[model samples]
Target chain A: MESFNLFASLASAIVLEAAPFLLLGSFVGALFEVLVPDSFIERMIPKTVPGQLGFGLFAGMVLPTCECGVVPVVRKLLARGVPPATAITYLFAAPVINPVVLLSTYFAFQSDLTMVFWRCVLVGIPALVLGGVLGKGTAADILNLPKPVLRQMDDIRNENHGHDHGHECGCAACGETHDESSRIRAVLVHTGIEFLSMSKFLIFGACAAALFKTFTPSSVLDLMQGNNFISVGSMMLFAVLSSVCSEADAFVAAGFSMLPKAAMLSFVAIGPMVDLKLIPMFLSTFKRRVALALIVVPVVTIFYLCVLLAYLEGGV
Target chain B: MIMDRLHTILEGLTTALLGAFMYAFSISDSYWMLLSPKFQPLTATAGFLLFVTGAAMTTRKPPRNVRRWGALCAMLAFLALACWAVLGPESAFAPDPPKKHTPMSLELPEPGEGFEPRLTLNDKEYVRISTPELFALIEGTNKEYPREIAMRGMVARSPDLDKRGMIAVFRVNVFCCLADAVAPGFLVSVDDPDKYPQGSWVRVAGEVVESAESHANGEISLPGMLMSFVSLNHEIRGHDVRIIDPPDMPFTFEVRDKEPFAY
Candidate 1:
């Protein structure tokens, strides 16, 4: 019973911390669906892969969505014909590169810019590389959407191509609502749909994380601290199991001041990109192969980078 | 069509319930048990938005295609989790010490005009400080250290500290939530370590002295620390110890600008 209670507390904490961001992301996605036209996205994005990747890498600076909320927005962008590379880059990079997360990292590390610098480097490089590699695939190859969802995307594309419904038509998809009341209602409906669609995955992920955190002894991670390779791996594993929000994870990493800088760096860097909560979200959002690539690429890239860092520091 | 409408309605109800659960935590102080106080307003706003979204959803026309059984199960699962959130214990269970030893220290406030060290408790005064704060104060440049000081922490047994006839008293510092909690505390030379059992909350007024002089031997090898425990250098000699009820907010938070307590 006590274990269950602990699990409940931890799970609730994860959910409550994430729920607001999820709602915000859903609203942003809904607003994008209602207000932003597909042509606008196409016209705005650069045609070249490099340009698109650059745009995706830094887009989070403006939108500033965290990992929890970034998925929904990325889904909307992808469905609306945003370049795969750009959307994928934004999906992975936005959580760490955004102002909120960076600021938190700065504060957590007592204004040490070095940690912040490495974090961006580690996450940004992998995100850009993945964007370039993964973005080459077609929507059919990358997206694991349901039939209805696919049909809806087709309908939007057809609608965009068929006729230009100027602002007067009051169509819900075109940002031209008959009145302010209906526009709000439209946004609400879209948000409701998106939230419902994504939140189940969040709940499942939180449950898994909470169970792991409650039952696993902290000593397990401690025992591995002697070896640099094992320490970095252990911390990365801890990051995945903890599934802590990127905004607050810096403080958690800072708590392990005794650990090597590489180990702590791995904890913060890997957490936002991949974790227990993100696995289900990734599987649901992207194709099996794309999702697998997304997970494997980041984990492998980050592990090598952190180990290299340990070697540079003479800990290896 | 009926199944479609039912599915939409159930999703709406579950959404509303989740909103209500969050709103309850926000309005009541129980939110601090799960999240930092910084998130209270955000939680409240999210709850309101979710409730509105859900209420609006129930009034909408049923979709042409029914939601899949998988979606329905997901909604049910979300509902179950939300129910658990509402029904479960508010505070997290006490944290166990991490296996890896990290010598804890706090950033010391600059010694200037506004530095006041004395804390008054129950009409009596003692130089009150946290274990981390004590560590900082001793290690810092200031030569004069307070003779009698009060510190509060949960008492736990440590074999290294026990070998030197001492018990550990440490407060768990939560960075964000319970998942990232770390206990950073002091070893105190007490009359009877058994009298203050593990996890018992205590407020001890003691003199800060060199650990070497406080115990039989100056050298005590901690499990993970090789010559690292020697660097701890200081321990508390308990003059007066009292068992106390755990504070409503048992956990200490990382010191940000001004807000000390999560609530």
Candidate 2:
């Protein structure tokens, strides 16, 4: 194929395949804008430091949004007086800890629960570590969002007239027409906005992944094979480059079956936590230093941890 | 006030265009070139949802745009991609030049240790099996004698197979999407090369032969059939490589939901 055709084919493939999941994510992200009142999460959060970290680690089981959807939720959490650290913990935890993502990881590994377990452990450990560490500071310390972006966060929070939806019944049977429709509209508007906002990074990321996939040859991937430590870093680096969603990245990792299990684990683990596309999203929500910390903390933790696992592979 | 509404409208318009582009591409004939047909339903449904969401944005009140310039740039970027997707030539999705170097990957597909074969000796009249299913069968089939399986695939004249007058019959197997599609095929020994042209769709029925060579060793090496405990591939040892019309279903689905082929 001509370079352009190959480029188009791969780019379009990545974009189209991911569009549905991205849309679903945007819808949910948008819904969080209106339906879940700002005060709701703040109230639910346990006051204790450990409680907050624990909540972030396991919240995905209750709410199964992938990495793509978690950003918006985290942003919303920050806006609603949810501690930046706790919200950051949720941000890290939501992608891998989530049920849908876990299930996808399981199926992609040919129904093996082992891969799923490792994926959770790898992701859980980081979010657990980061949630408490990163979660320590105030919104300004934790979130270095540009002034305008921070203002937008406020705008999203102020949507309910700075009012709590607590008085609103949680049940659908209430048949509250006025509240429901407005709620629905708010969700849609948010969905539209979020999709438009995030898709810029998504399209660019997908295109880059395709171009890399198309132009780079097999020998390039196999370079780090047999060497578990480098393989882990290499695959993790690839994960950052591809920026594939956690729900679907297993298939991509599985593509390089030759990569050590440790490497594949790192690929899936570090991907949801940080990536090129996600960096911008993180910047939009976090302080520059804080965002840099989010990336550095996990990348270092996961890489070394994965390298350790790679060394221990035969011992166990 | 007017500027806010206009920004909202432009946002709506950009989103609507994105939704429309998705919907349009999903239905276009060239869609298969971009994504596997199995994903059509999901892609189209998403497009519909996006469209509805975009339409709703027109009436729905938007949070004030704190960053108007950024929003405008996003709108333009979204519009440009959507426009390109809609108007791009069909060749954009397929190869304009012959795909000379589209090696499936550096690594061979994972061995089918736990996978069930697509066909068995008990099953009569071999019909069609996807490349992945066929490879799995070769690796997992426990039958003592080769199963008489009939299958169809496009001819890939690979030098790696290294057998004269034999061609690798393969199908594009989509594990997740087109981006992850791998060309997995088995070798078919044919009597004539003219009848079985390269890239021609053919149906061949034969006694399955397992290769002694281990398969999926990163590099695909098919010496013949890698029968149950099958390392990687299986071979169709028959002279009956007949020309056949391409099957309607363009790509194979996940193994669990695979059947219901439009043969």
Candidate 3:
């Protein structure tokens, strides 16, 4: 009963924190579904590979959102002709750049600014690399949805319910003279649909994280605290599998005060960028091959950087 | 037509209930079980937005997209409610405090001869500190004589209350959310432990002194204190345990610029 209560509370807390971010991200996505045209997004984005990758890398920081919310928004962007590289870059790089994430990281480590600076440097490198490499192909070449499913989605996008929504394409995407009420209604409908579609991953991820933390013995973490290499690896694994929100992950890392600064730093840096929860999110949004690339590249890169830092600091 | 209509009704119901549940759970103060109270306001907003989105979906004809996809929402809803039900309100309330404890320790040089002059100094002045800070101060022991400190927190009787002759007082130290909360404790040795019962809110004002014998998992520091102070020991303790009103927020942030709230 005690273990159950402890796990349940932890899981519930994660859901509670994620709910608003999910809603906000989905709401923006739903709005994008109608208000922004495929052409508009295409035109706005830089066509050159480097330009797209660069834009995606910095987009999330400027936007300032959580990983939970970023998934859906990236999915929407992909659906609307956003380049895969741009979408993937935003996917990986956004977490570290976020203002809330940075601030939380600062306080969680007892106002140590070095961790935050190092985190930004490490996260950006992999994110840019992943964006540049995997983003080579277009959505048609990269995405693995069945022909029928793709057709269905596209048909839904192009549907005109005999009601006038715009002047040219019968959509809000065109320079349509939409009444305030109908526009709001369209926004609501789109937001509702997006919310319904994307929320499952968030919920499942939270539950998985809660159970992982509850069952794993604190002794396991305590044991690994001394060896810098082993401790850093274990902490990073904990950070990813734990799937706690990036904004709140710093606190989670701090709770393990027994671990060295290197272990703690890796947990904070790697978590916001990618994790178990984001894996499901990636699968849902990108092709299976691309999703694998996304997870593998980021994880492998972070592991080395963390190990090197541990060697330098020498944990107490 | 009938099948389509039935599906619409089901989808609308699911969306509405999930949204309503988020709002209901948040408003009930049950959210403290899941996240930090600092995020209390955001919970309310999330609940409202979810409800609004659901209400809109209920109005659409035939619930067009409600398919196998909707089942995921059900799964999500079930997981959330299940967790909430298992973890009751008293999850944070530790009626029976643990016997063993781990306090903050650092490598500081031992105290020199003129460090304090007196082993235990008695004074009227009281310094305010969080439980963790209190642990740090006691660990360092630079002053030599214990300083008069006042701390507010939940009081729990140690399992070896009679054998050990002390009570454990602590506050749940939260960094970002409840998930990362750690309890930093201080064992106050009272003349009569029965006077202040366990699980009660009170203010303990006392000067923590170095223990005579080696305690549990005690280690000596580099320079200052010869013996490592694992447990809390107060020479001149405060008998006047004032019972105070528990504040709206039951957490202690305890960081720089972030004042520790009454917990």
Candidate 4:
């Protein structure tokens, strides 16, 4: 396929696939806005080192919000007096450790319970450690989010007074200001808007993925065979560059069956926990130092573990 | 206030209408048309028309409750149709088949040994199979062939299989469609790994051997499948390769009562 045509096809497919996910995330994140009050979270967050780490890991399992999109909300929690450490933990853990990603992972990896269990353990460790460590600092001022963006915090807070017709479920940020009549308008408009906004990224990712799959020669992947430092390094780069969403990364990883198992495991571990597309959102929602620290620390730790496992296995 | 009230009614109408449409679509047989090029454009146009009409009705003063109800019903009908089309004959509550355990004796190279072949041999051909069924068959077919077992299937690479060779051949069986399909890969130790590229269907017959390795805990266990066994199982099933695609069913109840969402 011509580059242009490939791009177009991929763009459309990605958006369509990702639409439901993004909307679902948005709906659930908005509900978090309503159900869990800022003060409650602020009060509930742990104050000590181990407490912060434990809370961070547990939060990742329970929170269903997408990591990338959840950044803004997590940042909102931070601004609302929630601890920076807890907020940071939520940010990192939310993306990779959620129920949706877990379910998808279980299905994609041929229903391997062992793989699923290790995935959580391997990814969750750094999220807890770095999040708690990073929380100890006073770097919130470095984030530099605009005041107007910050005002969205209050927009959700005051929503209950503005619009009330019925359907007062108060379950979603969008649903909160809507009566029955307005609910249709909200769902339609929101769905349409969301579909348009996110379709581009989805399509871009899918098309590129499919094209890469069809065109990329086997030798390219073969080059990274074995557990040599270079091979592990190259595969890690591949995982990060693929930027496959956490939910879909396993299929792509599985597609590379010719590659070593340990390296493949590393790809599964690192890709979803951190990715290029999701980084900016993380930066937007958390302290820059904190985001940077969270991303770099977990990746480095997991990469080392992947190499160690391969080494111990005599080139798995 | 009037406009807000009107908008509210319209919003509810749209949600309720879309809900019903999604529900119906879940149960409808024409759901596959949603993926069809010819059908998608038509549906998109219809959706646009409804959206515009919806916009107009909401913009009007004191949005008529009747129109709102009509819109809600329409939206619901559309949603119902979408849902019906997407989910076909699959419900979560359906009773599962009884679990059966198979002893490793049937698959063992030696009748008394515990090793079992993951794929089943049918009419001297190896059929693609799941782990459980494969084991079950092994338990049932408790006799070692005097000769090597030969099976024919496609050669596709699978992560679950041992990834020692450059090209791994696998055979996949499609029960319904590619959506809910399973493929089991056989480990073939290729001398010239590059000669047989990925995605090639081949016939391979090999004596399976178990190799032991030490774990981090210092316990030794065999994890790798060695190709002590040998046979060139047919690489291709020439005439029967073509499988017909089933027509898309829109909204069949998913056997599991999970949230049924139309794709």
Candidate 5:
């Protein structure tokens, strides 16, 4: 009974913290779908790969989202014909590079700008690399969307080509017409659908994270505190398991002052990019290969970078 | 077409139910048991958004090719979450007793001038501090040290502490949420620890002195080593101790500013 209480408390915390962001993200995604035209996106975004990656890197300033909320928005952007690299880059970088997260990190570390600088670099590099690598193919090759979503995207494409402002699209998902009141209604409907669709993944992720936190003992991590490599690996593992939010994760990492700086850095760096909650979301949102790369590439890159940092600091 | 409408309605109902649950939880006092007070506004806003969106969705025409299984699964998940939120413990987490004692390596600050404390009661010299502040004073490099201190927290007793004739009074420090809560406390060496009982709330006030022997030596146990560096080095020799009702907000938040407490 006690264990169950602990688990439930932890699960609710994650759910409560993530749910608001998810709702906001879903609403933003709906707006993107109904209001933001594909032509506008194409005109606004840069054409070259480097330019697109750079746009992706700083897109968080415009649309700051946490990991929980970024998935749905990325899905909407991809469907709206945003470049794969830009969407993917924004997916990873937005969680860390955003003002909210950076400010939180700064306060958490007592105004330590170096930690903030390194955190951005750590997430920024991987986001750009993944944006260039996994973002090569077309949306059809990279996205594993459901049949209804596919049809909706097709309807949107057809509507865009015909330049028709009429509500002739038969599908409810394609309710993006030029009518103001109808557009408002469509946005609300889309928001509702998107929120409900993504919530199951959020709940599942929260359960996994809560269970891990409740049952696991602190002693398990005590054994790894002696060695720098093991400490970094363990902290990274804890980041993935804890599934903490990017905005708040810096405080948690700073609390572990006993651990090496590299390990602490790894905790914040790897948490937003990949974790228990994100795995299912990634797999469900993207193709198998794309999802696998999104998960694997960051973990590998951050681990080695942290290890190198440890070596440089003479902690290893 | 009927099945499609039914699915759409189900989706709306489920979405509304979730929104209602979030809103209800955020407004209730029990939310403090799970998350920090800082998140209340955001939660309330999200809940309101979801409720409005779900209500609007129900009046619209049904979407084409609605995924029935997906909708049903979502409904079930939301229902489960609501149940969990309602049924879970409303109180803060009960601190577990330490299994083993291990000495902590903390640099003790020298007693010096310019020591300013947050709270003092009845014009007495005894300083009142939160658990997190006490932790900061110990772990921090602040030169100032108070002569006498008072703190309130849940009481925890175990064989290891019993052997040393002490009891731990701790308040769970929530950094982000309950998921990342850590119990940083002070060990009070009292004559009868059994009088307090485990998990009971109490206030302990005494002279601040370093433990002659590292009595309560154990690794600070919490999620992800939030304060793993802190061990039981400083203990209170209680001059006045008594059982007390739990505070309106039992948990302490991370102290980020110059002020001692985040509350």
Candidate 6:
């Protein structure tokens, strides 16, 4: 009975929390597959250092998925020959530094566009730069997954046999091979499959959050308030442990005004990239080593910048 | 062919679901807040347009011209919602005003000493209030006022009473529907054990106390409740608070526009 109640609550929270974003994320992913030129993007990665960073950041802004929702999409983007650095930057920054998230963060902080702008710039810059520096034309096969899943996905894409997908001319270029009816069916099945896979993790995160709010003692937060290195470290740790989705993180950050801006920024920057919840998805989707390196370098760099800013501002 | 049909059905369903989500989010209902702020009035409008456009483009049965119209309308709707959220007067899209706390004087309910009135009334208790009630009476009073106040709300974060005779309190203030709903703090606890049990929506007639005590959550608490009278209805199961205008609106706007309220 107790287990049933937990399951019920978890289900309620997941449906409530994940439904909208999951729908939006999957829809956007499908749209990208349809509308975006995969081969064109593959050819666009500049060999220069700054160019790679810029492309990575740009990709992050254009892609609309949240941290939780971006995994599979990032994997697909990588598989299509987008540079590892670009893929990694997009993987980390897409959910955290996107236009929607940036605007929402500004609104949450009551139109502090400077904070919004700096956050994106600060996080996006380093993520792109570090990812570029690390990837540096690494071998591609190391990142590739088993052949079967790719083949199956390709088959589904080719079949394109669902809904009004039989009609060909109106949709994206991929519509040529498969009729409109098949394409619609393929997208639908793809979406449902993606939802089933990620919704459980989303449900777990929501339930954990709800439980934390209900049971955790408020006195515990006092340890996090301050401008010192300890405070920054604690906040980052809290961010990782909480595993909050990027969309909802600002509010949590706002609830604590004592934490320095740099630390707060780092928390937001690092949480989506390195948290335990997202790590599994990262490993499965990208090369585990590449994923780990991408996350670690950004987190460390962002943390140092946070401390530096706090020191300069005389916050601690 | 069968797979194609199933896929089409799924696409149609996806479009409908997205449209329904946007529609539901656009209306700020009373019970809950939508989790994503991106699902604002503008987003909903855009999503609707996108749904229509996506619907038009993907479906073979639709007329040829429908896709263009759908795309055009979707783009237009997206722009409109974006504008409204960014520039609309009702939006918290602008910078927040500086915080000012000039506690409005609120009328305090008579501090009944020896024996308190039963807060969870077994029967309906008739209480009276002045026709011209001062907002001051309720503003900062920590205790429940004896006034017959009619504040409709949904049970928010009403946690079960701990062994220490305290319960975590929370409520959802609705400017619209579940979407755009904001969770405001209205922490209530009783001096006497189990006096005001958790999840009970009562017209608390008391003074909002100024003294601070450490909360169960370990944060040094600033405000607390000192209830003089409480009237709760057992029939009000899952009593969700739906306040149109909460007494404190400063932070509410930000909360509403942030997660759990955004569509």
Using lDDT, give the best candidate's number: 5
lDDT of 1 by residue, B1-263 (tens): 79777876876787887788778777774555556566577789999989999887776666645464554576566556545654544344443322232222233344353445455656656676665445445664444556567877777675665666778776655555554544556678888777787778888888777766443322332221111122266778887788887755565554322212111
Compute the DockQ of candidate 5: 0.31
Single-chain TM-score of chain A, each candidate? 0.69, 0.74, 0.68, 0.72, 0.69, 0.69
**TM-score of each model's chain B:** 0.68, 0.63, 0.60, 0.29, 0.75, 0.34
Report, in order, each candidate's fnat. Answer: 0.42, 0.45, 0.39, 0.00, 0.47, 0.02
lDDT of model 6 at position B208: 32
- TM-score each candidate: 0.71, 0.72, 0.69, 0.54, 0.74, 0.52
Error of 6 at B82 (Å): 26
Best by TM-score: 5
Model 3 C-alpha lDDT per residue in residues B216-256, reported as the tens digit of each score? 53221111111112344433255445656453344555432
Encode model 6's per-residue lDDT on B140-203: one tens digit a residue.
3333443322232212233343344333333332221122233333343434325443333334
lDDT of 1 by residue, A1-316 (tens): 6677667766666666666766765676566555665456557788899999998988767556557667756766676678889989988998888776787677566577899999998899889998998889755567898545875865775454332222212121221112224767767876776677666655555666566556654455446566779988988998887666676567566645556888889988999999887889899878888899889999999999998998885432
**What DockQ, between 0 and 1, does each candidate earn?**
0.29, 0.27, 0.25, 0.05, 0.31, 0.05
- Model 2 agreement with the true structure over A1-316: per-residue lDDT tens digits: 3455555555556666666666665565445545665465677788888988887677666665557557765765665577755787888888778665776676556577888888888888878777777777766566666445776755664454333333321211111112324667756766676666556555565566566665665566556766777789888998897777675676566545545788889988999999876788778767787788888989999998888988894521
CAPRI category for model 2: acceptable
TM-score of chain A of 5: 0.69
The candidates, ranked best first by lDDT, are 5, 1, 2, 3, 6, 4
Residue range with the least summed lDDT across 10 consecutive positions in model 5 chain B: B101-110
Q: After superposition, how far is residue B202 of candidate 4 from its true place, in Å?
A: 11
i-RMS for every candidate: 6.3, 7.2, 7.6, 13.6, 4.7, 13.7
When summed lDDT is taken over every stretch of 10 residues in candidate 4 chain A, the lowest stretch is A166-175
